[model samples]
Target: MSSIQDLETWEPLLRLVRAAHAEQLAAPGGRFTGQISLGSWTLPAPQPRSAPGRALQVVDMQDQFTAVERVQAALRADGASGVSYVVETGPDGRPLLHVITAGPAVEHGVRSPFVGALLLVEGAVPEPWRRLPEEFPGAAPAPSADPALLERTLRERLPDAIGATAEEIAAAEARLGVTLPDELKALYRVTRARWQDWSGDYAAQERVSTAVGCELFPLDGLYIADARSRPCPWQYAAKDAVVTAPDAAVQGLVGSPGWIAFGDNGGGDRLALDLTPGPGGHAGQVIMIDHERSIGAALRADSLTDMVVNHRHEWRSDVAWNRPPVVVQVSTHSPVGIAAAARPELEVLRIGPTGAPVSLASVAGLPRLRTLTASPGTLADPLEIAGLTDLEYLSLGAEEWRLLLSAGAVPRSLSAVAIDVPGDQHPLPVLDLANELLALWDRPLITRTVLEGDLGTDGKAGGTR
Candidate 1:
């Protein structure tokens, strides 16, 4: 048996634990192998003695960076934790694997008289076993215990492994006008997990169906459901909480004109009011206060204000585009309810018709924005983003042919671009844009352009819109 005293010593316990973990990892059924081993347990740098009586104050590296760092990163990356151990010095000269039991530290020399009968193979266990805390030293938990129950309990609150509902899938397909990838379909089979708040990984790809509660679902399923851009009718399970996703698909659905109208296709048409900063330094009121209050606040404070104040710098040919455009591709089952779109100097755009595209050009004055987009029928200029050096990821529909031809200077920062064009359009500007974007990023563009119909021609000009 090992004790807390054994753990107090730094070498023996660490060596034994590492060996145990390594053996476990190397087992055929282990999740990780060939990359784990026991290493020296480096203590924290020595500090000046405070009264030379601070219980031999020592730093536990295991606590600070090692514990969370190894486990957290692994979990985040969908991997397993690394193998490691901790050891410390004891009162006796001997070293031991600290096995703390109940409330006492057993010395390394205490071997049971029935040791032969009770001893098990030292390195054959396939699980981690920890000793009791210093309160009860020398006792180690039984090794080789099944970890399934423990892992399950720990992961219970996580998003479901299964995908979204059939209704959600059908809604998104109808809205986006495209089929989802098989990989995504597989992912959809798992349960979807709602983000605690806005802004995170899911924000780019998933949005909660406010119409539906922030139910747990799979990422792929959420994407298929257009969770990122749609406004869900689902009520949140938590009171006064907002459902969030990285993508804006589902958000778009809720905000679509039809949904807003609350008709069979368009129903959710309510206004939200809130206060904002008046032109100079004055304050304004929040209209339709009963609606989403926080969204209104965000619109007034961040989105609208940004559109007005940053328009020139963010999206103007006169300004010599310098910054990177905020390029976003929101595929959702509904339309986005843009709270603010009233600037006048903005440039660069990309628009898809999962829903309505109204007043999109209204944010032209936004100084920090470069490119822009909206539904197929609503584009100020398809190529308007060309002159904005910061513009990237442009999407437009076939109706904006004139806008594409009218583009002046191609944006330099465009490394990737997606355009919706008519079959007869010339490929010259598109090629030029691709070349320019490639030069800026020094990499090939990752693009997805949609044309009115398939342009089967294999030539560069023919393949893309």
Candidate 2:
């Protein structure tokens, strides 16, 4: 029933930062009422701000595009710090500009970075970084709340919180041949202090994870703990030469050797820092590397500080890519039970009788063991895992462990237990084990095993079918 003029399109995409909402966000910081930054001077269905709270009504409908420009200038002059859009319809209607909101201190005349984003570096930043905008226009590193707050967190923000001292941090850097970024160093300090808040075994700490980067070692354990460190999964596989520098080139590729893996994202993914900056990048930008992606992905944040503050915020649009499969992944190269001993930071362990089964004795010592991966027939010593009170994720043969669970040999904290299925789609003879594991559960668990490569032909329950 509408005219052709109203039949074009009407859509509102960007999340609106209502003047009221923006005001509320800035109140905590005692900032000024922010100025509005409209996407364009000429809008299709421009709303009139005739009401006292509305500012858009100042312009007359009869005004041409030039007059709209004047209105925009006036609004900017009024100190608007955000942008919004208008939706309209006409036979020849063209979609207007988009809306975007970025605010914290709106009352303090805080200007947003959206709209043109950044025109030029101008004189705000130093040289080298000045020309970085053109070199890396899409970089959006994280920011810090305040220096004092950061210092407190790094020092002793909480009672009983203790951070890694400068000497210890320096020593770690010497061993790794790299300097820790300020934010990264601060994060390290946080790790040491976590013990005060966390009393349970380290494996349980997985539940307390707040960001994509979990299981990250504090300054103390970075290079000296566990296997010392794992070279970037890229550039070096189980066989290729290790690459460490971000700028290191091989086969016409800029190797990401500078990435230092310090944190685990609970899942198989890893949280790392790209020490080798891109065109506009810095040495300590945060990045998430998906183990399943298999290299070529040197994903990075704008800076280490930015990532710390904006964790899972606007900066992270594609979050899933940063994480690996939820299940455990025992690399084919893990040579039996050695993975559990060598990579204590990892959640997955590949053990089997055929792959030079070293020893499951290490399981008792790993405070963070989550998932054990192997065919049930290959495990030389499932009994050795009896000491892991905080163990959670596990994969095994269907029928192999019915007695293990009934005998109370498994950890009570088990969350998920599953196995791979054969082509026949028949359940492995694990009824007793399943029932026993189910009895130990305080909550729901992943009892059904999935088919995975770690699942051996010997009726092991390692993978998801």
Q: What is the C-alpha RMSD of each candidate to the true structure, in Å?
A: 31.9, 26.2
Point out where model 2 deviates above 4 Å: 1-149, 153-159, 193-208, 211-213, 223-255, 298-300, 313-465
Q: Model 2, residue 368: what's the lDDT?
A: 44
Give lDDT per model, in order. Answer: 0.28, 0.39
| lDDT assessment of candidate 2 | 0.39
State the lDDT at 407 in candidate 2: 66
C-alpha TM-scores of all predictions: 0.21, 0.30
lDDT of 2 by residue, 45-95 (tens): 234446577555435443334434443554455454333322211123221
> For model 1, how does the per-residue alpha-carbon lDDT over 1-465 read when each residue is reduced to its tens digit?
111122222222233333444443333332111112133222222223444555533353333234334333433343322222212222332221212111111011111110001101222111001111011122222232223432232234234333457676666557545553322232233333334333365542233222111222333232221112333211110001222123211111112111111001112212211112212211211111113321211121112122212221121111111111222333244232332322333233334554444444344335645444455665434454444444433344434533554453445443223334444333334334433434443443222222121111122221112
Q: TM-score: which candidate is best? A: 2
What value does the lDDT take at residue 67 in candidate 1? 30
Deviation from native of the Cα of residue 170 in model 2, angstroms: 2.0
